[model samples]
Structure formats: C-alpha cells, structure tokens
Target: INSSIRSTYFVSKLRRISQIFYIELTPNKNLIMSVNGIYAEDSEGKFIPATQRPDGTWRKPRRVKDGYVPQEEVPLYESKGKQFAARKPQLPVGMSPEVALASRSKKSGPNVHCPIPGLVVLEDKTKKKKKKKDATVEKLANDLTQTKLDNTPPDPAKRLKNLKKKIREIESIEARLLSGELKCPEKDQLDKVARKIEILCEIKEIEKQIYWPIDTKYDFCRRL
Candidate 1:
C-alpha cells in the first residue's frame, strides 16, 4: 500500500512540473501588443539617410603603389655578401681585361693550331693562284659564248615554223575564250596575241611583194 501511494505522489509532481513548463513556453500576448503599438504610433516609416557615410560621399579610391620601385635602386638579389662577389667571373693569370677583350674580338681560323706568341701562319699561294686561274677560265668561257652567238646565223625556216605555230595557238586560245572554256582571260596574253597577229600579217605582205614599188622621181623630192 505504501509503494502505491509513493508512485501516485511522484506522478502528480511530474504533472505539475509539465503544466508550469507549458505555461512558460507559451508566448506573451502583452509583449506582442506593445511591439505592434510602437510600430503604429508613427504614420510615416523611419527616415534613412541618403548616404550611409557622414561625408555624404566616399573618398577617392587609393592608388596601387606595390612593385613600383625607383629605376636608380638595384633590385633584390638571392646571393648576399661574399657569395655574391664569388659569383662574378675571374680572369686567368697574366691576362689583362683589355687584352682578354681584344683576343675575344679576333676570331681564330679553322686551320689555326695555337694562339701562342710569334706563331708563323704561312698562306698557301699555290691554291689561291689555282682558284684565280679557274675564275679567269670561267670568265673567258662566258665571253666566248657572246662571240659564238654573233658568229652563228639563225635558221629562217625554223623561225618561220615557230611563228606559224604561235599564230595557230593564239587562234585556238581566242576560239576557247569565245566558247567560254576560259573563265578569266589575261589582258597581257590578249595583247601579245594581237601583236603576233600584226607581225604575221607584215611577214605575209613581205613574202607577197618581191621588190619595192618605185614612185615618180623628182628633183625636189631628192633634196628633201
């Protein structure tokens, strides 16, 4: 009987604690009413300034000055003190800086052995003479070609045949152009064809007339 009474008492206490917790968790109506009344008190909304800043506008943006070192100043180097000095090139013994520079300027030939003092370099004149003789022979051969051309007579029959062939080819080209076989005809080619046609006509006239025609001879015409 005592255990049953104790259990009932514990359950009743838990119920009372739960009731108090529910009341505390529930929102207060009075606080919500006060907040709504504060908002409605003023008809117009709270005025916001045109700009957030007190100066009315922001100051000019700062200019970038990073990596803008002066030209007079030397840039930072990885090496420091003695290590940096050691990195510089050192000249050999008995060699002055000016002498070293002069030696570098003078390029040694492929045939040169040692650049020691008092080195005798004898030039082979026999090879130079042979080369000069060969060049003279070549020049003589070129001169002989002009003489041969002047002495040689051109074959009239071969020239006439070539001229006739050119005339035929020009005619065929014109025919192809008229038939629309050639899309873009060259002006230079057309002019050449016209010139050849004129030449051919003159040659034909020369062949037809054996002798020059004589006009009436007068004393005044002979003086002019």
Candidate 2:
C-alpha cells in the first residue's frame, strides 16, 4: 500500500513539471498573423519586435529573413468622416442619417456619470442667457425704430426726415469702430453701445419701410 502511494506521488510531481515546461515553450497567443499571405501592419511605427503588441505588451511571431520588420500603418484622421456613404457604417441602407449616426456613434464602454437632470438648472440658465440676448436685440431694434420715427422735438419734417439722418449716424458709428476712433468694444460701455448700433444698422432699411405707411404715401404726396 505504501509503495502504491509513493508511485502515485511521483506521477503527480512529474505531471506538474511537464506542464510548466510546456507552458514555457508555448508561442504567445496575442501575436496576430495571417493564415493566408495577408498580414496587418504593426501600427507601432517600428518593427513590432516580432513578438509584441502595439501597447508594448510582448507576444511572439516568426521573425522575417531581413532583420528590418514592418510596423503597422496609422490611420489618417480623415477630417472627412466615413466617406463611402456605406449606411453610416452602423446601420444598413434605407435608415435615416440621424439614426445611423446615433447608432454608429453610440459609446461602447463602462457606465458613466451623466448628471443630466442635475445639469437642468445650468442648461436652463444658459438658454436664458441666449433668450436674453435675443430680447435685448429686439429691444434695441425697437429703440432704433422709435428713434427714427421720433420727429421730436416733435417736429413733423424732422421725424419725416429721420431715415437719411439715421443712416449717417449709423455710418459714423461704424467708421469710429473701424478707425479705432471709437475705443475698442472690449470696453464694457462701448460694447453695449456697439451692440445697440449693430442691431439698429442691420435692420435699419427694413425697419424704415415698416415705419412708412405704403397706403399713406399717396396722402403724404397729396399733403406735399
């Protein structure tokens, strides 16, 4: 019985040693090679050590006859995206571009912290900022319209004459900005003034038409 036990122990020891030797002799599993004559470029910009991954992890492959080895080619950034029009790459054809982009661009990693609902207040404020800018522009346009139509000192001829006069004023403002005769807009007060002037100038001609009554043109000529 003791002899049988000793023999079994010897067999187990021999098996463990043989397994370790086999492991040491085995080729690395990570090295990629072509079954057919095709091989992928190493992408590492150097002969990838015949036995290593791009990340510098070691692997094993047959060395070429010439000591020089080819590296993997790097991909071009292709400022133009996915040019082949191959259904945006993610979806088959006939899908909407929007759906294709969304699907193809889907993130494929670990779970992330979005804080989306938490950003509600921040996004709301940002939206409000844009709205405020629009409202301010609207207000500025209104003010310009008011200025042009105001013949004040409330004089009829002066009010009637504002369009040409206003054009000159707008031009003067632009000249000042261009010539540096007007201090740079980086100055706060100047920026406000510049913003007001820009909106007024942009819609000046359009705004003028709104002020003039098309139907009343006959009446005005009659008055004249």
Candidate 3:
C-alpha cells in the first residue's frame, strides 16, 4: 500500500512537470549598441569613430572646403576656355580606362623583388618558364592505370552465370512431384528444395537487372 502510494505521488509530479515542460522563451530583440564600437580597416588606417551620442544617426557630413564642388557642377563653374585640373600630376597610367581614356594594357605597379641591385626588374619571364616546366612534368607522368588493372582480379561475370545455370538446373530437378508411395516427409523436402532453388535464381536475376528501367507495380500500392 505504501509503495503504491509513493509511485502515484511520483507519477503525479511527473505529469505536472510535463505539462509545463516547454516554457516559451522570447528573444530580447531591442538592440543595445556594443561598448567597444565597430572598427573597419582601410588603406588610410584603422577607422574607429568616437561614440558621439548627440550626433548619432541624425548627423550629416560637413561641407567640403571652398574651392570644391560636385564633379559635374565643377565643369560648369569653371570658365569655358580654361578647364580646371588638379595640380598633382597623376601616376603615369592616370585614371581608369573608361574615365580618362588611359591605355588598359599599361603596367599597374613595380615588382618588389630586386635580385640584382639598381635594376627594378619584373621576374615575369622566370614565372612563365616555371609554369612551362610544371606543364611538361605533368605531361610526362606515367599512366599508372595499366598497373591497377593488372593487380585487380578478373571480372566475376562468368562465375555469376555458372551459379545461375546451376541454380536453374537444381530447381528443375526439385519441381518433379513425388508419388503417393513417397512419404509426407520426402514430399515436404522436395518442396523445400524447389523453393530454395527458386529463391536463388530470383536473387541472381535481380542482381543481373538491378539497374533496370522500371517495375510494373500497382499505382495504389505505390501511392500508399
């Protein structure tokens, strides 16, 4: 009686626990800004702006210096005969091909490596030669496929065919019905043997056409 009462109490506790097993958890979606601030690396330097709360999201960029105007408006602002260009002479290649009509094939930057002093040379030809050598090495690689074929045993097609043929012959022999003179035990043995042989043949045939196109299965059975 005591054991039964104890089990009942435990089961009741389990049921209560299960009732509230999954307490719905809500994610706190209201975002608070990170304390460290976001940092982005650039060519100039690592950019980390001060967390200016007063000028936060509503801030606009300060206006450019007096001479500067929008690139399109600058042309109109200048006099017709004299176009204004930056005093700074650009790198020899100038700006992009589409913008300034500079030659697209013009070299971009100087080579860093200086094997021989005083000559700022590009190791371009040496790189090409190395690539050619790599190609030639790949081409001369021995075809190791023949070695693989030699190591592997011959195909099992002939063995499989023989086994199937033997199974068919055995099935034929077992199918002969026993006379009344033969006991029930003998007749049962013959039936068992015939069934086993049939199964073997079926397995072999299935193996042969395992990759066949389709089966003539009933649509109702297939759907279920």
The C-alpha RMSD of each candidate to the native structure, in angstroms, is 30.1, 24.8, 34.9
Which pairs of residues collide in model 3? none
RMSD of candidate 2 to the truth, in angstroms, is 24.8
Alpha-carbon TM-score of each model against the true structure = 0.28, 0.17, 0.19
Error of 1 at 35 (Å): 91
Best TM-score among the predictions, by candidate number: 1
Q: After superposition, how far is residue 120 of candidate 2 from its true place, in Å?
A: 92
- Return the clash pairs for model 2, or none: 41-72, 42-71, 42-72, 43-72, 51-59
Model 1: per-residue Cα lDDT over 134-161, one tens digit each: 9999999999998999999766556566
State each model's CA lDDT, in order: 0.53, 0.50, 0.46
Winner of 2 and 3 under lDDT? 2
Model 2, TM vs. native: 0.17
Model 2, range 53-163, lDDT digits (tens) per residue? Answer: 455344543444433434544344554455655435554445566654444454453222334422211235567689889999999999999988884455444544664
Model 3 lDDT per residue over 1-224, tens place: 99998997786666545433311121321221233333322333332322223322222223233343345444345554444445434533433434322222224643344344332345586887898899887766644566676788745565566666766655555554343443344665666565664556555555544434456332322232
Model 3, C-alpha of 134: deviation from truth (Å)? 1.5
